[model samples]
Target: MWRIDFFLDNGYENVSMNDIVKHAGGSLATLYKHFGNKEQLFIYILEQKSEEVFGEWGRKSVCYEGRIEEFLTETGRMFLDLVTTPDAILFHRLLISIGYINDSRLNKTQIQNLMSVPVIIIANYLENEKVNGHIEVEDTYLVAEQFLNAVKGPFLFQTILGIQIDISEETRLKALKQVVTIFCRGLHVIQ
Candidate 1:
């Protein structure tokens, strides 16, 4: 797992099963049998990573049910942490860079689908929050986009454009808190 991540981080384009076999110190036959192909392996890795994050999110959200402030506070903190995490940002940048390039192994549809995972997860969380009476929004999709934009816009701009800016933990927490607060205002249920 670390080998594949390292290779991707090192800007290896068109990572193949052979590459995985050599880098991962595993047999090509075993890699093929387990993951089928490079695309499958990538998707599998993404799923594993998503599970690691969302599993904790699930537990925490459920535990903090009925308390929108606490839920959003915890969620925002965790989410900002995830967004700024080195591994998460690196993998995200790699995916964005590779997603547009034509790979012989994975087609356009598969890549598009993989890229939509984040939006899907965000929308699902917003929908769940709404159902739990945490926030009231007419459109979860748009709300999800806004939520993502609030969190990702600055980080991605700096990352992709090489804009040097001091990003402190305190700044991240403040940004996250503001995003949640503004979003909650827009989504608050009318009494």
Candidate 2:
């Protein structure tokens, strides 16, 4: 928790093994012995936080009284709630900060791949839906990515960048309906 806390509170570039060890109550040798280096430690923390943040969504069931709109609405609402969270925003900003540091040894693509749990979840759902003739998409993965990016991009970006932190429930619901409707229409959903 301390390792994640340190990195999220202080930008990734500003934190050090010493700072972590100091705050986490561990010796530098032990930290090095366990994590090997700062990069590994950061990666470990990133993976841990990623799992913690996304695990619940991954566990979300696609079942919603057999309604695709209901499933999509739930997913979109969850995504909106997830990204607007303070912890999530800080985590996202940490990633953004890492992007500007060349010496971090972890590239943007690496982080993106690591953080692709939502895309995987969506793709699997879309693939299942397509098989059942509930939707039609040439490529489930690409369509899933497009849906996720389009659905969550604006409000997420606004809150994350401090442009607008408190999106009203009415606004979120409206956005969810619009995104889900557009996505379903694009996919040529049968229902």
Candidate 3:
């Protein structure tokens, strides 16, 4: 919690274990004991934040069992909302900026895990739909990734690059609907 706040306020590269201990009023040994190291703590913070943003969707719940379209629409909207936030953009930028630094606390595996949460959740839903014969996807992972990118790509890039400050809810919904339509049509074909 404190670590997340500290990281957000001070940036990932700027914050250190000592700073976290000082601000959090905890011992370094305790922090290390609980989180293993800075990378682990950072990953934990990411997991917590993802859960907060995505709610039960982040955990692969089967809430959309009989309604694939509803699931895609809701998940697309939520994913767009999460990634377009200023805080999310800043966090992503921070991660990308420091990702290649020598001996960086964040590593490829940790970053992949953080990125994989939504994909995994979406893939689980897709797998369920496939089982029900509602859709046919040879690779749920690829489909999930494509669906996410279609939903998040335009707005996320614009927000991250300062090209667009904010997108209207109407625009967001329309785009999401368009993507869901395209994806559903493609997946509903006889196979």
The candidate maximizing lDDT is 3
Candidate 3, residue 82: lDDT: 77
Winner by lDDT between candidate 3 and candidate 2: 3
Candidate 3 local lDDT, 1-191, one digit each (tens): 56476777787788888988988887999999998988788888877777776667745457667687888998998888878777878877777677757877577787787788888889888887888887888999899999999998768877767785547888888889999999989888333
- In order, the Cα lDDT scores of the candidates are 0.67, 0.78, 0.81
Q: For model 1, what is the alpha-carbon lDDT of residue 62?
A: 53
RMSD of 3: 2.3
In terms of lDDT, the poorest run of 10 residues in model 3 is 52-61
Candidate 1 per-residue lDDT over residues 1-191, each given as its tens digit: 63347545565465656766667786998888988876677767666766666766665545654555566667666666777766666766776677666654445476566555555655676677778776677888777677777876666668555566655788877787888778667778433
Off by over 4 Å in 3: 58-61, 189-191
Candidate 2 lDDT tens digits, 10-115: 8878888898888889699999999898887877777787788677766774565346777777888887787777888898888888887777776566578778
Scanning candidate 2 in windows of ten residues, the lowest lDDT window is 58-67
Candidate 1: where is the Cα deviation over 4 Å? 1-3, 12-14, 107-125, 132-134, 189-191
Of the pair 1 and 3, which is ahead by lDDT? 3
For candidate 3, what is the lDDT?
Answer: 0.81
